[model samples]
Target: MFHISYTVEGTWRLLKRQGWSWQQPARRAIERDDSAVEVWKKETWPRVRAVRRSATPGSSLRMKPDSR
Candidate 1:
């Protein structure tokens, strides 16, 4: 180490002077499949969203049965 002290403000100023700026990371993973996403949106998501509560008569939200 050269024993150089740098503050956050000073480092940002130096970066800006060198034509660099902070940027947000990409929202999606690099391994994301665009075609798969499109297929899911077209073929699966609508059917999933259209399913009504009455269609699932056997399903329950309760984690445990109520005590009598």
Candidate 2:
């Protein structure tokens, strides 16, 4: 049985030579409706905000001042 082994660089170079370009998929859908999104946000954003506020009581993400 024979198998080919490739280093990371070798595989990347092979893909590059094949015309592959690295990219991330778009976060938003191309066919999304902006007005519908705005309406959903207006109705649901308050509840989302409330959940976070209720989950963490008196806790802050900010760092404490230096006490030195």
Instruction: Write candidate 1's Cα lDDT for 7-57 as tens digits.
Output: 999999999999998998769889999999999999999988965556545
RMSD, candidate 2, Å: 10.3
**Backbone atom clashes (below 3 Å) for every candidate:** 0, 0
Best by TM-score: 1
lDDT of each: 0.87, 0.83
Candidate 1 ranges beyond 4 A from true positions: 31-68
lDDT of 1 at 9: 99
Which segments of candidate 2 are over 4 A away from where they belong? 28-68
Clashing pairs in 2: none
Please give each candidate's TM-score: 0.40, 0.36
lDDT (10s digit) by residue, model 2, range 1-68: 47988999999999999999788876977899999989889997877874443555563658875789
